[model samples]
Target: MASSSGLLPSEPRTLPSTGFQVVDASETIEEETLPGYHLGKYYPVRLGEIFDKRYRVVGKLGYGTTSTVWLAHDSVESRYVALKLYVANLNNTRELKAYECLDEADEKDHPGKTLIRKLLGSFQVDSHSSNGSSSHLCLVHEPLGPSLKEILDLMPPYSFHLGFLRPVLRNILIAVDFLHARAGIIHSDLQIANFICDVRSSDKAMFAKFENAEFTQPTPRKIISEEHIIYTSRRMSLSKALPLLCDFGETRLFSEAGTPGEDIMPNVYKAPEVIMHMEWDYKVDVWNVAMVVWHSLTGRPLFNGRSADGKIQDDRIHMAEMVALMGPPPLRFLERSTRMTRALWNEDGNWKNVAPIPDITLEKLGADINGYDKEGFFLFFRRMLRWLPEDRPTCEELVYDPWLMRELGLGLGR
Candidate 1:
């Protein structure tokens, strides 16, 4: 039942206890699922039984909920990495000690190195029989490309471009300011399917400009160091490039943290002060980088919801459909957001805790709110979707915004 080429059946399977393994409804299911296929959260890791010996696994290519990526081949740097494994259980020793103190603070105070996803070593195997052993941890990355939601499903859209979103938001604000000032950490899951890209400069710019195209194929290999085709040709040459916020498995560490009102994100990029319990910090990663730059300039999702067999919706009904498209939540942002006024819109202030509100508004989250000439991108999405994370803005004042220095004209002083 687990076969989208993730094989698993020769009898004797037994995974559950939450390691997941229940999607066998008699096979036949397809809808472009691969990049961490999913059932309960991935249950397949077989690149020829973990490719015998000194690192080689080369396959799984993506996953989360405490890690699982692969595309190995590094018999000591013969190159072709992107490992990421980690999820062996000891209940993830404080996220593997904050990913080994952000890889030793990127070998002591970065100057390049530490844009997250670059571990490159960890091993321990045994316990699938022949009497107990268990410790299978792993992480050895740097295989980029294919995930900007697979390059916005192979591009064909455009607008917004502060010179390619200022070098992908200056490499996600230098990896979130080196994980909040050199490894204090706080990623708490940034979106865009955890960004990655480079596949050898997307096949030398698709072999120097569309060589025999059909959306540039070319994968015969021999040097295409993944970055998922250089971030799918940087979102097909900047479709308002923004995504780069990566996955640090619900990250945290501004000194022994977590439980700053749970629901850590992905519940529609959480953060209404961690869904109304408040006490959060790193401004809940600047309101999840303003709801992933308003779903990369509105491909839509300033909040959405649909299920009831409408196919699994309800992330607080897409944050009450993004507070009815960015409007009602201000009563001075519900009295200075004590996690949205005493734990989410209750006590007769109703909103039935921000239900499925969106009938739609803000000229429908934009894309021509009064004929788009990009009016400072909806005033930088209303100053980064402010709902009182101390009135948002601050990734160094959204990297000096003046509409991002008059759309990259310069003057971008820190």
Candidate 2:
């Protein structure tokens, strides 16, 4: 039956009896084996299921611990949007508040604002199941393509070209600047996975093809019970690539200063202040941006925090690597959190030898690029990778760094 909007067919699309494969129940499907996954947790979304009487679910995009994202057609607007449906009873008010903070900023002319993925709308959905009735919060956003890491993985060498990397890093810096300066927010998590390619005009065609494929081929899915069905995620095809910083689940808001003593950021990208349990602010993001840029240029992580067995994360090992690369933390820097500092360092600002420092330097590691480019690259890294968070350059300053501008073939004037 045609919906009242007359833009989508609200009835569920019938799948072919023989064409599509039925996944075995015993095998782990998309989110079936997730730690907290159970009946009534994730909304049992089906193809062609309409939400809010407007968005028609077309295909599964991806899933995370807190939510499952789907590609949906907005019948009211006649555009494709990504519906991020959170797990039942998940507290996502922080993420919503971060978006609101960005929205409140008066920076329409800010270049970084465009490089950030925008929240179009949001609503709540009620799901009734054998377990109980639960409400899930759903956020609507413009559908985007694969992440920078995913795109890099698809191509051989799995690293971005210097030419392409320049603009991508610049865009990221701009986005970070907007978050720090204009929006009064801190994106505590900044990594390659959080940087995604924007959907272009050419990429919009992929959505129609995805919908058509769902109608004819139907995604292979595991049917566990009446309340649960797990569908394989479908990747969106993207021809034109533009970087957009996304994922605000770990974002924190700071007005005029810093937020202290809160553990944030992924292990590999943690700032020195974060490790020492001291006050941290926008500079932590600066450190994160440096690590991300370094990782993008080289396939390997700049700092590997894993234990020798690679079974668990060891902060001592991570600090050892940091000292070896960036030199030992200064006495004053260590004094910020005396208790935590004493555990890792001596009175003279020397490492306590819980883990041996790796015999590596930035100069030795970044040996690929030659001469001027190498010098400039390391200079840029020096500006951000400091032992003290306050020593790191602001995102605004990094955006106009000589090395980045020269690589992008832009003058300081621009």
Best by TM-score: 2
Candidate 1 residue lDDT tens string, 125-212 = 4334232334545655555556665664555452223344445655665667667767787877777667664444323232112212
User: Model 2: which ten-residue window has the lowest total lDDT?
Assistant: 1-10
Give each model a TM-score: 0.30, 0.91
Candidate 2 lDDT (Cα, 0 to 1): 0.82
Per-residue lDDT of 1-414 in model 2, one digit per residue for the tens? 232212344444655545667898788877777877676788888776899998888899888878999998887777778999999888888789989998888787788889999999999999887878889999998888888877877876777766678778889999999998898998989999899888666456667677777767778888877656788988777547787999898888886335556778888888888877888777889999988988887766789988999988888999999999988778889889889888988888878899999899997887663334666678888898898777888998988888888855685432
Error of 1 at 100 (Å): 29
* Each candidate: RMSD: 21.1, 3.5
Best by lDDT: 2
Query: Which parts of model 1 have CA positions greater than 4 angstroms off?
Result: 1-71, 74-81, 90-124, 127-133, 137-142, 145-161, 166-188, 191-193, 200-260, 263-270, 278-286, 291-329, 332-375, 388-414
